[model samples]
Target: MSLSYVGTQLTIYVGSAILIAGVLGNGINIFIFSSVRTYRNTPSTFYFLVGSIHNLLYLAINLTFRIVSVGSGFDLTRTSLAWCRARSFFLSTISVISFTCSCLATIDQFLATSQSAHLRRYSKIELAYRIVLVTMVVWYLQGIPWILYQNISPISTTCVRTNAIYAIYVSVYLLLVLCVIPVVVMIGFGFLTYRNIRLTIALAELRADRQLAKMTLIQVVLVIISIIPYGINNAYGLITTGMTKDANRILIESFISTIVSLITYLYYMGSFYMFLISSSRFRHAYHTLCDNTTSNSSSLLCLVDDDYFCLCDINQIAQCFLYDKTLDQCKHCLAQGQCIKGDTDTPSDYVCRCPRCHFGSICQHNTKLFSFTMESLLSPDLLSSSFIKKSVSLSMYIIVPALLLIFGTISNIFSFVTFRRPKTRLNGAGHYFFTSTIFSQLSLFCLLSKIIHIIINLRGLFVQPMVNTILCKILSFLLSSSTRICYWLIVFVNIERLYVTIYPTKRWLKEPKTAKKIIIFVIMLTYGVHIHELIQYTIVPDPKYTVHGKWCVTQFSHSLQIYNQINTMIHYLSPCLVNLICTITLLIRPARIRANLDKKKSR
Candidate 1:
């Protein structure tokens, strides 16, 4: 196989950029959070730091593959099945570790911030170890997909080998374990935290109130934001079924899918930012470190081979950032008074170049620089060419969504019916809310799966405004409505929890009739919002026009796109804001109440 110079160069450039960025960003994070003695060891930070490490590892694996594939055209059979299995296993484990760590962090915050002593006791090291061990088990168990699917097909040009049946089973497993479990857990934990927060506020427990509330908001938002893109992407992969031998189509789809997969990294990256935003201690420490650039503090610098640079105090960090750059002090800078006393020639520090800077360096005079835009990132020609090469079928499309809808319906119904009985009713509103969440999850999963199925199935069909007229509309509507339904269900549960906690004596909550009504109303209202999707997903096919083929499960009309973006903002972004606002309000109310009590006692 021969590689185009441009393709090889681009691969190297992108791979290098990703590796460098991941190393620095995750390195600084681990150092600041782990080594700093002042950080007051919290379970939240521990989980977060570990998660960052996992993210860096994930980046390393991805970068390694990108570089190797570009250089050698990525031959799987030549590399042996062992190499494939190893790569798959490493990738899978790191990915799991990243999300699992985030989950643990959320769980930690929820427990730590909760008002109940029983819940608060969950902040033990033993529990953390147990969680970590269990997560590892989950990772290995999930590796069944890789073990089952690992093979070398004669026609496959790429290194990775995947089959339709293997993909479907893995997709089903991933959807259930990773995507659905986290969604349900986030909603459940968020509600539990909200409830405990309200109780704390009523009792004037300000510290716990603020901490728990902020952490809850951060965890919920970060998890949701990061998971959705990758989740949807995987859902598409699962529904679209089959392993094509087409090198061109596979490469193009894989490249685009790689960008989508970055959503997982975004989730990991956002945690540091969330901590910066929501926790004052983190913010103060970060700001203080940034502002004091002149300070020769050990915290900021490490001597490496007689040159100064940053070092982190972790196994992962040290492994990632140990630089071997030769010592070359900035002679020009020293002569120009840019260097301080005793500063001979030192190696140029790795600095971030501005996107708008002309040169990839810190310019003395700022000049405009060109960077890759979204248009360049996703070229129209590339998309069209990729679409042209796609060998897709109607059955692939139909069966995938049908499978998802069926699976979702069955899972959600089981969750609801099993917990609906009088026997499990005493399990509390947490269990009931869990059931409701499963319904929303199924709704979202089915809608996405169904739509992708339609678009792919209809690609080569000559039916114009005939076969797909009604189907498109219903598919589109159901997808949108189900997603909305699921999003709002979570918020409803959170708000209900707040109500129950603050007003525990309310007889309405105790009444089975009232609870049932609330559940029905929430479910009905959620599905009602999805009605629009039912109306709009359908499109009139043109006899002369071939549908643009791709693996993503989304409607691309401007109006629909705008609506979905808004949906993302409302269901995805806005709830985060609500979580933050509610948490702050809950915390502040108690602080003010406590101050008044203190004043009274002093008087």
Candidate 2:
């Protein structure tokens, strides 16, 4: 048999073993961490619980996919676009979540063992849940682009990226997310944790503290070791693509690829073993759990030694198991000013469960130094009353727009009259200013119409008047075209000023005719670009709102999102960039001119 065939067979056998062992191990880890009260309450264990779940999923999905594809020669992921996208999305998202949870556990351990009380208090179960929730949301959103751009190849019957650029982007993104960022965070925090342990050896000697630090260090080291080879392989593949076509080089790359694949799987498998070997507490918990199962006991009692498990009477066991044993004494609650004694039936339940911000088993933390409710400051009903609502509406939609319309119309008219005087009419600069005032007046008219529409809608007086197809199209087209023209006319005026400032001897650029031609071109260009508004926008019936009423709506294609992005870049961002450049040049020109004159005088 060929060496490649032998290697493939060996991988199949070894991979199957690893898959079974990893699934069993992670399943046990989850059961023990969740069942034991000691492990369940601690913050780092929450991260470990979540990480174990993610690792189990990663191993099962990834290993099973590989096994099936290799053994039966059937690749389900290559069957359709949905499968391809789903396969990539799940694989990437789950792997990243697993790594994130591991990193969080390390950080939590460091904080929990810190000498600073503020940092130590941050190690709460609620905070761990919040962090995990945010991580899942962020990673899931990050996978959306992958789903949008992945496709199935018809020739090779495999899933691949749709664009070469996107392929390169995914490679770089994975390199950073999977390797670079994680390595840096783990190494930096790992070093700090080690130093803290060394300096505070007496504090670190506690069993719980030592266990947390040891487990976290082992996890960090395992993560760093497992990911390095995969990262290197990714970098090599990205660098070597299309570079050479030698058969020997191809074989070498394939060998490295297989080794990296195995190494990646090793990461998923090694966590359970790491926990088992690094912590005696975890081992003892596992053994007790196994012993209980073998003895066929259905009791809730998790019998660790007398010190670990909170042993109490049968009735007290339920309360102690549910909450901390410290609550039974009620000293912490009595110290706070909120204790309530219980009746004869359950006299031990003297701790009052205050429904406010206080910590500890008996609510002794007293987070509220100055007790006050949010409603006392600002009531929701008061804010939502008719007077406040109308005041805001009148100021925004009525008063502001009305004042702007009045001032803008009067100013534009005065400017027109001033520019038409004999002394200004023949000036090239006056022509540009004159054209700009005209477009600005038109733009103001469009704005006034829109504000009136908003006011009418707010009053609920016009249900379907503007919903007519022709009216909708005409209003949209007029508003967009006028606004664009107004902005571009300002740009033209700036350019004219810049030209005059730079080359005072250029007579053609100083002509009024040139200004007029540029104004005509600006108007035409703005109209042509926004002509789509006339066709794309129309009236659609709104059955949910009113039976006979319609709404003005614009129908969009899949490419509309891309078009919107390009439109924003060109119309909004391009003008700002150009205006900034021109302003800077204008500011610097005087200084440069003065410097040149000074040099000439000295010569």
The prediction achieving the highest lDDT against the true structure is: 2
Report how far residue 87 has shifted in candidate 1, in Å.
Answer: 1.0
Q: Give each model's whole-structure lDDT.
A: 0.53, 0.66
Structural similarity to truth (TM-score) of each candidate: 0.41, 0.47
Which tens-of-lDDT digit does each residue in 1-603 have in candidate 1? 333454456565555444544555576568766776544355666776777888777776665455545543433334477767777777767777777777677677678666555777677556776777788788878786786677656575334547877756656767766677776777777776676666653211223535435755676887788777777877777766665548876666676565655556566455555654565433211112322344534334232322223433322122123444434323222001122223344343333222222211221122211112111222223234454433343344446667776787777777777766676665245444555656566565655555454444435443444545555555445555555555555554565555554466775664556666666775676566545555434332222123442221122353443344334434554455345434644554455556669989999
Kindly list the per-residue Cα lDDT of model 2 for residues 171-236, writing each as its tens digit.
Answer: 998898988788778888887777767766331122236676788899899988889888888887
The per-prediction CA RMSD against the true structure, in angstroms, equals 30.2, 23.6
Candidate 1 residue 134 Cα shift, in angstroms, is: 3.3
